[model samples]
Target: MGMKASYVVQPFELHRKRLRPARQEAAQSESGALKKAENLAKRMPGAAALRIVADDETGELESATILEAFGEVPDDFAESLQGG
Candidate 1:
C-alpha cells in the first residue's frame, strides 16, 4: 500500500464557555498548520486549546500543543507515538 502523509491542526472551541475540540485542518507544513490554528484561536474568542498534529499513512502520528489553557491532549494522542 502506498504511504500517506499529512499535517493537521485543530483548535479547541468554546460553547457556552465549555471547552471542546473542533474540526481538523490539513496544512502544508507544521508551522503553517500551527499558524492556521493560531488564527482560528484569534477568530474564536472562546478557543480553549490548540494542537498541531502530523501523521503518516503508516499510522504514525505526532502532536504538539500551542495553547493549553486546560492543559489537555487528545485521548489517543499517546497511542499514536507507539511503534506501529
Candidate 2:
C-alpha cells in the first residue's frame, strides 16, 4: 500500500485537427520533467510536465498534477489528465 510519486513529460501532436498525446517520457525529478517538456514543446505542438502519485502495490493512480504547460496545449489537458 505504498504511495509512489513519478514525474513525466507528455508531448502533444496535432493529428487530424485534434491534439493527441505522443509517447510519454519518464523524468527523474519535477525540474527534469519541466525542462524536458519545455524542450519538447519547442519541437512539438505542445508539452506538459506532470507529477503523478499512485499506489505502488496496486498500480492505481491516486492523483495527477500539472506542473507546467508550454506552447499550444489542449484546453482540456488538465481535465483529461485527471480523467474528468
Candidate 1 stretches with Cα past 4 Å from truth are 1-5, 46-84
Error of 1 at 45 (Å): 4.0
Superposed Cα deviation of residue 63, candidate 1 (Å): 6.8
Task: Give the lDDT of residue 13 in candidate 2.
Answer: 98
lDDT of 2 by residue, 34-78 (tens): 999999999999999999999999989999999999988889888
lDDT of 1 by residue, 1-84 (tens): 344544566555656766556776667865566566666766654222334444545554464544433233445543443532
Quantify all predictions' global Cα lDDT against the true fold.
0.51, 0.94
Question: How many backbone clashes does every candidate have?
Answer: 0, 0
TM-score of each: 0.49, 0.93
At residue 57, give the lDDT of candidate 1: 52
Model 2 lowest lDDT segment of ten: 75-84
